[model samples]
Target: MNAKSSHPSHNLPSRRTLFTAWLVLMALTVGTMLAGHVTSTRSLGLLWTGGLLLISWAKARTILQVYLNLRAAPRGWQTGFNITLIMLLLLLLGLYAINALGLIPR
Candidate 1:
């Protein structure tokens, strides 16, 4: 490696790749939210919201692992990311459950 490329921390996806992924994620999230408009049920609306959250999580993970080369992340970082992913999933599920139980509005 060259002198300037000696540091692993300096290696990362280009700004263009990051921005492109962000745009794609935003589009998918909006599409997921718009899915509710096709249906009249509150449960469907909640499901759409949860789906969007999960899709966003997946897209973020993909960008991290592939574009950002985070597949080789440090153990701590990997663990923390996994925890955050799980928490997001739990939150999404809880939202759906609450709506399903009639404990919250759609």
Candidate 2:
């Protein structure tokens, strides 16, 4: 049998794929910084905060799929991880919204 067929993690991503993923991640990082206004003292309102959260979710998914090689795992595993990440991000956004709305005291 060929080496690929014999390997358990046979569907590893190619170098080109890795490079592309890296580029996408870098671009998302820049997007996050811009959306969050990292270089400025300005506060990010609800919409910008949501955009930043979405960017972070994308970055996390990319790292999990590409860097951690979770893409080669079973579909159930992928779904589970995705759900977990989504829940976590939702929780963070909820907290941010509450604080921004002055529901919580400083």
Candidate 3:
């Protein structure tokens, strides 16, 4: 097998890959949101949000693990990233729960 960096299987960044991935993700997210609006279904909003979040996260993780090759990143970076992600998720959940319970006027 070729060396890691030189391997065709590698997904390292070269500007083009990053730009294309970003465009595709944005397009997909926008399309989902538009479809949700057109359908007039509240569940569609939830679906759009959940799907976009999942796809966005997967793209970021791939960029980090394959492109940046940060699987071997410093432990502190990994821990910090996870903690930040967790906190953000918790905040979103709290907001959603509050809205669902009608505790907040939305």
Identify the candidate with maximal TM-score: 2
Query: Measured by TM-score, how close is model 2 to the native structure?
Result: 0.87
- TM-scores, each model vs. reference: 0.53, 0.87, 0.44
Model 3 lDDT on a 0 to 1 scale: 0.60
lDDT of 2 by residue, 14-106 (tens): 999899999999999999989999889977988899999999999999999998889998899999999999999999999889978889766
Query: Per the 3 Å backbone cut-off, how many clashing residue pairs does candidate 1 have?
Result: 0
The lDDT of each candidate is 0.70, 0.91, 0.60
lDDT of 1 by residue, 1-106 (tens): 5876666556676778777777887787677657645455554656666676677677777667656667556778866886888697888678678767789656
Error in Å for residue 45 of model 3:
7.8
Q: Model 3 over residues 1-106: C-alpha lDDT tens digits?
A: 5477665345445687667667776776676566446557565444455554555555555556545655566677766776666577657756665655678766
Ten-residue stretch with the least lDDT total in model 2: 1-10
What are the runs in model 3 whose C-alpha is more than 4 Å off? 1-40, 43-56
How far residue 8's Cα lies from its native spot in candidate 2, in Å, is 3.8
Considering summed lDDT, which 10 consecutive residues are worst modelled in model 1?
Answer: 36-45
Best by lDDT: 2
